[model samples]
Target: MTSTPGERERRTSERVIALLMLLIHTRHGYTTAQIRRHVEGYAELGDEAFEKAFQRDRALLEDIGVPLSLEQPEDADARHVVDASALLLPEIDFSGAERRALLHAREVWSETRLQTEVMRAVGLLVDPGSAGEADDGLGLPRVVQRLTPNLEVFLDAAVEQQVLAFGYRTAAGAVSPQDRPRRVRIWSALEIGGAWYAAGWDLDRQGERLFRVSRVIGRPEELPGTGSDAPARPADWNPVEIRDRLLGQGEGLRDRVRLWVAPGRGHSVRLRGQAVTPTAQDGAAPGEGWELWETDRPAHDGLVQLCGGLMGVVQPSAADPDVVAEVLAAWRRVAEVHDGAPPPHPELAKPRQSRYRQGQRERVSRLLDIVGLANRAGGITKVELADRLELSPKALDADLRDLQYCGLPERLFPGWLFDVDAESDVVEVRQAVDLPAPIRLSLPEAHRLSAALDTVAQMPHADDEVAPAAVTAAARIRQVLADVGHTGATTSVRPSTGGTDDPGDAAAVVPSAADGGGAGGHEPPATPVTSFWDVHADQDTVRVLMDAVARHRVVRLRYHALHSDRTTEREVEPVQLVQSGVVLYLQGHCRTAGAMRTFRVERISAVEPTGEIAKARRRPKKTMLTPVDTTLEAVLAWHHRIRDLADDYAPRLEAQDADGRRLTRLGLLSEDAAIALAGMHAGDVEVLEPAELRQAVRDRALAALRRLETAVRL
Candidate 1:
């Protein structure tokens, strides 16, 4: 009978563990012939099978950071030995504050792809029993950072020093069949401004370049040769500084630019600029009145592009005719695009395949932990072992059985490395193994820990407490990894703070000038950086809300509703914080509205505790955070160009039009939301059903055009 995948995996695990235990237990190590003759799995295999299995097991051990060394005596078969000292993680004492800060930093990646790695790293470093349960009182907002599909490809390339080739799209262009292909030797990978970026030496250009992960047109393939043929990364290389130099080339206006804003709109603009007194000379006011704001222009073409996106609400002052003309031109282009027939959907980039199975790595990690845990306890009960490791009884039994077969060849050693007394419900090691101490951190694990520490270090903290501790802890870990020859793993990639001028400002969405092609088929000037939405919320606001929630207090909020284009004040009983994609939401029972509501953290203009204790109430059922009710649904047709956004709506594809537009039914919270969605991606998205929504989108677009014309002629 053919063995199942489970049996194969168990056999592989047993063989690898047995080899490791044998090498560590015997100082002189074992030759291949001796290992094959003695190891249980190898003894049962044919000569050809034994060779492949032995080689695979050896590679697996080395890949996971096991310090396995090969030694050859003259005219003798090579011997594989485990460097016990090098395999152990060095002892680094952490202070109380540092420990708390480190734990908190680890918590930030709670639900992210890196969570498992972060947890494993923490488990190895901190004594779980002594490290008091992560303080839940603070209720830190959970951050969900989505890794780009190509991130692993780049990471592996960097670590292995390999060359990679991929199709790359520039900031000004979408992914197309005619995309320019580029080859690179990846030096580092980092996340900045909520977007992942790979920095490396462009092989074709013979210069360093940075490429946005999302802009990669297709899967990156590894080139045959290693990066050893290319120049090494500079000693002073810093991805952040290099990215800034490359992207921040242009200068902004030296003086402040005057802007007229409609009431309750342009919050992102307002937050950056100061409100100015509007005069009669400012021209005709729209809505209640045009609020005049003057703020320093951002670097490059950011100011123009920023104002262009807020055409209906924001207008540049006539004092600068050039700026006004540019804004007007942008508005006209948007209007023309909306008026024109929808363009065919752009070709979407193919999702890259992950290099390895996460489950496989996790399983290996669990097995290693078992050995370390069992060794530390001298002998642990099976029930206690299962509970501690969070494993089912069956799994525990299976692992024990695998461990029982792992040892020196039966001829060399009479018994297995680990002896399990199933009847007594006890697991004990019969022979000494160097694995009692935690193994060195793997490259991926180190990267995750480094990234998490970088995030915590950047966050705002009271008295600047946690930030300093995080920075110190990161440096210590980096040094430890480097000392252990894990230099590649120590490369830290920090997620940028949205590149905002004001640190306190929440992540804002600045529309790309090239989003809508202009009239006459003219391409807009390339943006300094690709448009990206930051996922991190304002730390100050999140901290206050968390406090209120912990105290069970009623809080007053000044929230700006995007769909309605209005700000409202309401009292709410703080409940929990929820993170979905690039948006953070505060889910609570709204006392003012007498209903459960989810408020976007970015839209919350102000949060103040009312000092009123909230009444006891049952927690609301967990639901996805959306602006509107799910019961009301809207049918929309969106071109594949904006498929990423469409995918967020849990869309059911009804049909595809000739233009490659997909008709999808999506849930809507309100009519205004449907209109806002269509208007935001106008020309790319159309309201297919609910005739009223289509008309509303048209009216909004026309009104915006009229407003732009009025502002231009002033």
Candidate 2:
């Protein structure tokens, strides 16, 4: 009797698992005859049928990321042995804090789609039975939210750098039910005020846009076609910068408004409010709980809308005749919005879109370029590939994993598809696919490069060789654009003021001041071109610290601590570099303090690598995308417009206040963090406690104002 297809599949799966177990647990090689005798399913099949099934099973295992290997028989006594790693799952080395954070996140997101993902990830890393038993006396001091299903899909696409098209619900069904669909390339996913938003490059608008996860009506499906047409992002594009810009949407000049939110609805609000209280106030409805909060922020419709229904203006008393009508009017407008009418400011109700992060896209493009170049070179080692891409080995491995599925659908059998063979010490690219020639230079790249070349050519006493070379390269790039039939005036090249007369000679085709080096013919040649590597610290010092971190070496640093108000020498085992906003911090183990510490790169006056491997290796080996400090905790408050900044600092949300203000416990690295918060927001930020930090902020503010006065005089 013939077996049903389902039966055959079940049997096949069982056989595959059995085969895997045999290979994984066996101490010695097993021949085909020996395997047939030992295994159940194979015993029922003839040699031909068994061989076909074995081949199919091997392919399935390989496809599933199983590191399977076959050792060939070389001599009479030797046999072909199937060799594989002992464990099917890769070991997870998350720190106690990270695991705890993940555990809490899983619990928080339990009912949502993100909960499953978090649980799965955590489950794979930790034993399910031991999940929440004990704590390590460490609080990551950050709120973790679940990813809506829509977000997970978009995030995956973003990681793959794939373009997506999806339906976005601009208005609630109670408002505008019509579906608004758009095509975009996902650049970032951020959580602000406990809501998730995705920012990306809008294909139709030829600009960047943001979408709220809750506003997204359905799962985003991958758009058809290669992402070749997507414009290249700028090399200096910073995601945090774009996120901050988006977060600042509709913000006005500072408005300090005291308010109270209903109990249980004040978490987002309290993260930025000073003197947050959770209790029913005098006029609160009986049995109704209230959270009182005060905050200073730029007044935007977003703030008013956030406070509506859930919170209300408490100070500038509602009973006061001077402001009673204004407060009543604001609440009335909010009431109208909830009643299915248009918001007083429709824009405030809509999600805020931000400019595409140019730097991240450039990094993705560079990754693709490096992979293509290395693959085309034939058999380039992984080390060489990493060196060429200027990426760490860990980073390079991640890129390769993402790029493995980057080709056109495998159904077409295109020879241009790429595959990575990462078995040996070297990474081998097999079945290489050629990259489709990029249609044109990214606008920012061309614009910036042109300005740099022009500046170099015009520099006083510039080296003849360098100046001429810059001019020649610029002209060639412009010529390529012109040859591609671009009709824009930016394609034009003019002669340099003192360039060679020969058309074929270097500097012969430098664009004149009028042409602006063939970059839109707009900006003057002297316009400054921003460098991607601009930083507050010495480049040499940063390089040294980065090397120490990578090599797991100790470094002696002359570091300035804002809390202590002094500079001192300390030996630190470099862990990793973290970027918060525009500042870079070196997180490591400090021998002086006998604990892990975070030191700002800018605060380090000098760094000398010890050249010895560090003994302290307790710090997590992986990089953190944001600031995380287990040592110091500061309870403070602020306005909501700066929510992105607060999240970047990884502050733990406590309670909500009226209109975009909330209380939070922020994890601090050093006094620099307080200074950073104070400086970034000026009077808006109130550093509460530790007395030292508060004084530091005051001193820094006074010093900043003094510097401003001095500059004004100069």
Give all candidate RMSDs, comma-separated. 7.6, 20.8
What is candidate 1's lDDT per residue for 1-714, written digit by digit as tens? 999998878767766776777788778888988888877778878889888878878877876668888899999888988887787666679865566666765655523445556766776665544434434424455553344567667766666556888886544333434445677777666554344567667766666667766567678989876555465555545544433333342233245688878876877567557987866556555546678888766433456445644546677765677776766555454445455344443333323432434554466666777677667767767766674555679877776676666655565667545665555678776554667765777765665576676666654443245666766776777777678766553233332322211121111232121211110121111111111223335657766876777667889998877655667899999887765544567878997889988788767868889889987555555445543546567667765444445545656435556554567777886765665565444355676566566655566657776775676566
Error of 2 at 230 (Å): 25
Please provide, for model 2 over 1-714, each residue's C-alpha lDDT reduced to its tens digit, 9 standing for 90 to 100. Answer: 999964565455545544544554455656666666655577778889988977776665443223456555667443435433322232335444334433433332211333333333333334333434453212211113323456556544543346877766432112123354677766544432234556556776666666665556566778767456664333334433432243332234335555554454443345345754433222332124544566544222334333321222122222223233343444433222222221121111222232222232333344444444454445557766554444578877766665554343222233333466545556655543333211123332333334334433332111123334445544544454345342123212321122101111111011112111111111122111211111234445655765576567899988765433455789998876653323457888889999777787656767897778965465565545444544667766554433334544555545544444445666776666555444434334556555666665555444433332332233
Instruction: Report the CA-based lDDT of candidate 1 relative to the real structure.
Output: 0.61
- Per-candidate count of clashing residue pairs (backbone under 3 Å): 3, 18
Worst 10 residues of 2 by lDDT: 500-509
Ten contiguous residues minimizing lDDT sum, candidate 1? 516-525
lDDT of each: 0.61, 0.45
